[model samples]
Target: MKKSPRRTFIRDTAIAATGFFIVPRHTLGRGFVAPSDKLNIAGIGVGGKAEVNLPFAWNNGSDNIAALCDVDDRMAVKARARWPKAPYYKDYRVLLEKEQKNIDAVIITTPDHMHAVQALAAMQLGKHVYLEKPLTHDIYEARTLTKAAEKYRVVTQMGNQGSSGDDTRLVETWIQSGVIGEVKKVHVWTNRPTWPQGVPVPKGSFNVPAELDWDLWLGTAPQRDYNPAFLPAIWRGWSDYGTGSLGDMGCHFIDVPYRALKLGYPVSVECNVGSVYTGFFQEAIYYESYPPSSITYIQFPARGEMPPVEMIWYDGGMKPPRPAELQPEEQMGELDGGIIFEGSTGKLMAGLFGRKPTLLPLSKMASATLPKSAFEFVENGSDGHQQQWVKACKKGYGAYTSSSFDKSG
Candidate 1:
């Protein structure tokens, strides 16, 4: 007789569930779930996005949050109040080392620069990971993480929730239907830099706050003074800690045209940025921070029967030319940003998160009947984004996921 691998895995995993609460089968109602069935999850950067991300994992009813790690205690206060029982740590390395036995997976919502190291370490330990967007700060890191997912054979997903949305699929269908003809160009714009950017590095330093671990927050970044300018989300605008506006929103908007047109790695990229002047006489380059505004153009080769495509990105209140099809009263994109695909025949557009995709020339949209939905909507829609990864973890690796690190990273 051969041993059942499922039973073997459960028997072995029982050793790791030392302190987990196991709901008894009889009291579990019709669907009696065993303790071993749920994934014991840990969270890194358990604030900001984790405010919603962590709760989404728990909402799936098949995940148990075992621990949380954050560099600043003040920022983590809200998360701690919600998941009071989960053990807390100030550093991710220590959390991974000490709690390795207790966790089955990890959710990394940390800053851009710190993402690669923390995620790579978790993968090395055989834990699944759900990383936030712009998977890495560098192209090298992105390639490394993508390859590591296959090497480690772990379930991996990026935090580009739009990948799980039906709107993304709808855009694909419209393009394939030839309604928009061949998409030769795309314009993606955002109004980010709502935070500070294009400024000189702050010379003044402040004493580290009692609740913050300045050293830990610096992570892989070079050592620097404890400046508030780099903390509490302002880091996104800095060169050392963040990837600028392009890095901030690229993954989200690019995912649309990239997936819709079946685009691949860009062949060439060109960009221009606005100058940051600090004084009446001196124009500050502020290499330390991202520009106040910038525009980048990326060219992708043709795929299969599709023609070569040119994609443009705008940030810091800059935008592409409005389409002639757009009415005088109609808005181009929302205040935050939007994605516009230009085909020989017409254009299709969507707002942030790829919601509410519509064809230009409102009349065309009203008269044309949509083709049968060629793509199946993710169950539970966008909220299912987190749960999809959670289910894949429980279902074992190789389970299909929309934004697997191999694709997004």
Candidate 2:
């Protein structure tokens, strides 16, 4: 069969223009199917969580994996196998430079520190972006990326899947319905650091693996020996490359309440962290590493009629006191952790990703009769988060996505 003229133009014009293919409306004549309008997507850091994220974009049925970039060849093995036709690059800079016109969007699942630079570069070139969550490593980067998205007028979505889930909407409904009246306190906890933390930085330098680029792995972080602890996975525990447990999972657990309560920035924050043993009568303070455990208290000012909200975050095998209403045999949250909202009238709780929410005493949950709120649901549910971005991309900027940079950042 002869190729659709539109498809040929999309490919040829993309390269000829030098960057960002301008789709001509006149050429999209009759019989040119909508589903055939594939968005060429390039992936930066196509491994680890990207193992799942890249697939999410592919399953959306609107993406062509045009390019893949990763510093570690060993890490990129699975992704390389999945899209063997897509050219691979050891440095994202080279990939973006060489394939600028070939891709319409970019998916960034790199380490927290590298997200902003990679994303900013892609957005500057007019490519839509799907960034992994927490939005960025620091507040400044988050703010910058948020503004860039607006200035560039490109569709953007943070990879917080729960933001697109029914749980946030359900909680939003219950809060709006006053089932959990005037929530003043929220407790969110997680069991992370499943990697080593609160320890001295490894002293000896290890040989960099042949398959990995040591300098690229360190990207924005300061120079350091190529320790195994920093490679492949354990980087989450380091302050230089990772954001601790809070940075790693904060977007996932905190997103629901943040969306449900229509929250704003915190007014103040205070924290207490568990200690690491180092010497006799001395607790270790590895400023380079995240604490073994911590309790962070952040207070948000009241919004209009809403009461002031005190949100506490706990991580590293620590959790808030179990709710008095919960039975002794019942688990406070699942093995990983959970969230609890304490309100004037009652309490509501849910596990990670805002799953299995329940009202206190079980009876309150059973007795409460409520209609589903008008909040729109993602067509395929939580898993459709990536697909949501895909739709918004095809529809252009300002398209509805649950966790756009304006909301998530």
Candidate 3:
């Protein structure tokens, strides 16, 4: 008969992120009682990025850490120590099977390759999921998870915290409001590959680490011998195991233009990669890993009043040419990466996650009439993203999330 306290927090949280409210199911249809006021979340990969994600998802103990899962116990130390009582499992399937009734939701921060399987397994059990970004390994997996989330009618959100940021919605509003004119081109670049990339696979027969289940860690991916080089968050460059820098950061950098402009799918795409030559004119060919850098060109078709948008992605330190409109004192994006939008009237640019958005040439703002961001909800750090999902799950399905499976897919 009344709004749940969790639902009220979710509404206020949504107002911070999108200046909107998450209407509880009771208001729209039959009342739906959530699993609990405090969601019981299980982490599939409780290491690497999970170290940061788990705590944010926990949200100051408002939620319960019902269970934990990770192939490498070494990677699970902090999580296990934090929630010493939550059941831990090295295999996700076993975790799901054993703790299905206990966990109301799952936070899957596993690598890209394992996201689809781990997410679907839990969603099939009707558990809400907060999956890490680059939603799935590829298009097929993305589509599968997208369709499954809709079919199962579960709460879903990707790990792109920027989506809940004021800048994200600001960029969306600015572009959609035509302040940047009709965006015809977008350039996104990231300085990733901080790990071993463009190098030959490590060659050696090392005993599998006692802390890791080599076979379990390689779930759904091609079986391979375990090597220290592939982990500790260094798997992004491997073609077999990771999606390179693009996957590592594309979802964050490119997501702005894609959402702002509604670029559904690319019509055509081409890519070129930098070469690593062992000697002059002698290229060191390595097929197992992504090249040191790459340039990708994707062409998207026009929709409604919008024209065809040309999106270019550069990684491994490559970046688009500096816009002449930018003054000498100004910088394009931050050291990590940035995104630039080219429209008919002027250009719009922002650093990673579309933060610190600026119109080209510092002088433009004086004459330009900018629309108000209209966003009342603002989140600090990356807590808003996961908390949005937690609240959405508490409110039941149909609650709003910026990067749901359908949008991310």
Q: What is each predicted model's overall lDDT from 0 to 1?
A: 0.82, 0.81, 0.82
TM-score of each: 0.90, 0.90, 0.89
Write down the TM-score for model 3.
Answer: 0.89
By TM-score, the better pick of 2 and 3 is 2
lDDT of 2 by residue, 178-262 (tens): 8878999999998886998898888886788899988777766676778887766788788888899888888989887887787
How high a TM-score does candidate 2 get?
A: 0.90
Clashes of 2: 0
1: Cα error in model 3, Å: 42
- Candidate 3, clashing residue pairs? 15-377, 16-377, 16-378, 17-377
Model 1 bad stretches (over 4 Å) = 1-36, 279-281
Predicted model with the maximum TM-score:
2
Give the C-alpha miss distance for residue 188 in model 1, angstroms.
Answer: 0.7
For residues 147-248, could you state the per-residue lDDT of candidate 3 as single tens digits? 878876788999988887888878888999999789999999998878778899898989998888877777666767888898867887888778889888
Q: Candidate 2, after superposition: displacement of residue 292 in Å?
A: 0.7
